[model samples]
Target: MTDQDAGPGPGRTPRLPPRWFVRSAWVVHRGYYRVTGGRRGLWRPQPDKWGTLLLRTTGRRSGQEHAVIVAYFEDGANLVTLAMNGWAAPEPAWWLNLRAEPDAAVVMRDGPRDVRAREAEGEERERHWATFRQLGTDVDGFSVRRPHTAVVVLEPR
Candidate 1:
């Protein structure tokens, strides 16, 4: 677990880190992961609660491969994540890429696998959100600050 998640109970919403801090850390994090060949930075979570996965998606406009380390939790055999851009107002690029092309790849501790992404809706969204809440996350609090907070499910192909 990281320091960000070490303090108080999950019910207390932690302040979002500064954008500059997050961007700076992301640069270092990507560099470390590239240098370690997936041996390091493979299980990083922001709050250090949920598991991590390396999600690769095709850039919607660039048509280039883009990989991002994302926090995720397993729901049955599927992986669930939020399309929250560091809690920023803008939507995440990976989620946009997935919307353009649902087919993607994810690297987990087990290994890499092809997967299909879909936004959970209605009952499914509620179910997943409830599960996150049960994990002690203040999902509604953070989600309310943004226009869109998609609940994404990645299913193995």
Candidate 2:
């Protein structure tokens, strides 16, 4: 089966590692950050429609800060993230970290914002999922993934 089809199997879980890939991606991302002086570069689109941000949160176990790139959707007064990737089932490390410690920080072109993370439910989940689809194309199947895929909402703390 392909990576996307390889849902969670026995003893298999979604994880972000493989040291080599992580390190290489980090190097490239860091270089992009430096070249842009933390303003905008590789990741940011000229007229960025979908809000993208750098999330910083403390590790639950290590008590250290971790940062990641994530897309956000505005929900009245909150921002939401869609944890979708074309590989494996189950949540990723970033979502796990947020669950462990809801208090987090986000940096966008506008500025930094203190936020709290929570998984969306019921109508809220459906609303944000629709907004997510409007922000991009070819993600119609995201919400249907059900209990596995989650809409993580981040509100001002």
Best by lDDT: 1
Error of 1 at 131 (Å): 2.0
Question: Which window of ten consecutive residues has the lowest lDDT sum in model 2?
Answer: 40-49
Q: Per-prediction TM-score, please?
A: 0.84, 0.71
lDDT of 2 by residue, 1-157 (tens): 5433454444334334554785577557756766887776323323325666788888878989987777675667687787663323556677888889989998876778899989999998888767766776334443334357777999998
- Model 1 misses residue 150 by how many Å? 0.2
For model 1, the run of ten residues with the poorest summed lDDT: 3-12
Model 2, runs deviating above 4 Å? 1-27, 42-48, 85-87, 142-147
> Could you give the C-alpha RMSD of every candidate to the true structure, in order shown?
5.4, 6.2
**Highest-scoring model, TM-score:** 1
Off by over 4 Å in 1: 1-14, 44-48
